[model samples]
Target: MNPTRHAVSLGLRRGWTEFVLSLRSPQDQGFYLFMGVGTLAYLWFNRDTELEGTGLLLPTFALPSILGALIAFGVVIGPAYALAMEREDGTLLRHKALPHGMQGYVTGQLLYHSLGLLPLLLVILVPSFLLFDDVMSNGAAGWATVAWVLVLGLLATLPLGMIIGSVVPSVQKVGTWGMLPIITLSAISGIFFPIQAMWGWLQAVAQVFPIYWIGLGMRSAFLPDAAVTVELGDSWRTGTTVLVLAAWAVFGMLVTPRVLRRMARRQSGSQVQQAKEAALQWVR
Candidate 1:
């Protein structure tokens, strides 16, 4: 087998093993449960409320957007945390010692983070259908849209996480460098309300990021044609969503490897030891 392919295969297996382990871990289980329950509770409480003039139930409008935000949040933050922690613990250095190891490590990360999303999605989506009416208006077509939007969203956002992880000064900095930014984006990205309600420049800033397009693509999937009136330009802008997400994906693909390489080149035993000592001091 080609060396890179063999490395990737190993990475895939490694990722699967990690995912299986995560499923059995109490901490991960608790997180999944918390997110599922919290989201469902929010939707349930708002079940009777309608979106002002749209005549759509709040849950019906909110669910897809929430899912989109989750996708964006999960893929980006999850990898960022993983990479940062692993870097601090010498995992990246260990991988650097092997032939084509970085490739395998990256492959593992991509797969692990991508698969981790399933439990969260199932937790939210399954019960959501059981509890909500008109949850999915377009049926098969809607589902197909869901599939593509998820794929593109993953491609667009996951690299940002990796890049962030590769660049942050330390694992502790991820909050300021990664989490805060994502939270801010979610606020402006129409996950909670219509984007049109925001000031014009805020709307433009929001549209520049993948979170907005991901939410929009998701809304387009589950929402009926009439829901477009509540969206920017009064259309789903499916083409624009794809174009924007693909552009991000391309940018990530071109940039992430270079960033990772630079970060990798700087890793050393002394740096790792210094990180450990810093962590110990912080813990103290």
Candidate 2:
């Protein structure tokens, strides 16, 4: 096999390994449980509640939106934290020494993080089916819509995470630079509420980002046709969602490689040492 292909294959295997390890790790399992339970609890409590204008129950409306938020959150923060930590721990430096190692490393990050989303969706989605009715309104077509939207959303947002991770000074900084903004965006992107409830300018701003569109697409997938009454413009705007996500994916595809290349080029023993010292200081 070609050397680069060999590296990518190893990376894919590494990703799968990491995912399996994460599943076995007590801390990670706890996190998954907490998220799944918390989400299900929230939705369960609101199971009987109805949307004001649409007459649809809140859980059915919120489930897909929450799924989108989880996807956006996972793909972004996962890579950011991973890159920053690995950079400090000399993982990137080690990769930098090899032929096409960065390629392999990036492939691993994408695979691991993307696969990481499965348990998150499954834990909630499975219970949701048992607890709620008509949760999937558009039937087969909606599932197809979900597949595309998820692909586009991941393509759109994962690169941003890589970009942020490449630039951030430390893993600690990811909280400030990555987590805060993403969490804030989730709030405004209508994961828990309607975008139409926000100010017009804020709505416009939210629309510019993929999170909003992802949530919108998820809603379109899960909600009945009548639920469109609550969405902005009273439509799913599927075409616009695809366009915006595609644009981000394109931008990321063009820019992330350059950024990663720059970052990789700068990796050296001294920088990795400094990063380690800084991390130790943080621990102290």
Q: For candidate 1, lDDT tens digit of each residue in 171-236?
A: 999999999999999999999999888999999999999999999999999999998999977989
Quality of model 1 by C-alpha lDDT: 0.96
lDDT of 2: 0.92
Give the distance in Å from residue 221's predicted Cα in candidate 2 to where it truly belongs: 0.9
TM-score of each: 0.99, 0.97
The CA lDDT at 111 in model 2 is 92
Tell me the number of clashing residue pairs for each predicted model.
Answer: 0, 0
Q: How large is the C-alpha RMSD of every model relative to the true structure?
A: 0.7, 1.1
- Among these predicted structures, which one has the highest lDDT? 1
Runs of candidate 1 with Cα error greater than 4 angstroms are: none
Candidates' lDDT values, in order?
0.96, 0.92
- Any idea how many clashes model 2 has? 0
Pairs of residues at least 3 apart in sequence or in different chains that clash in candidate 1: none
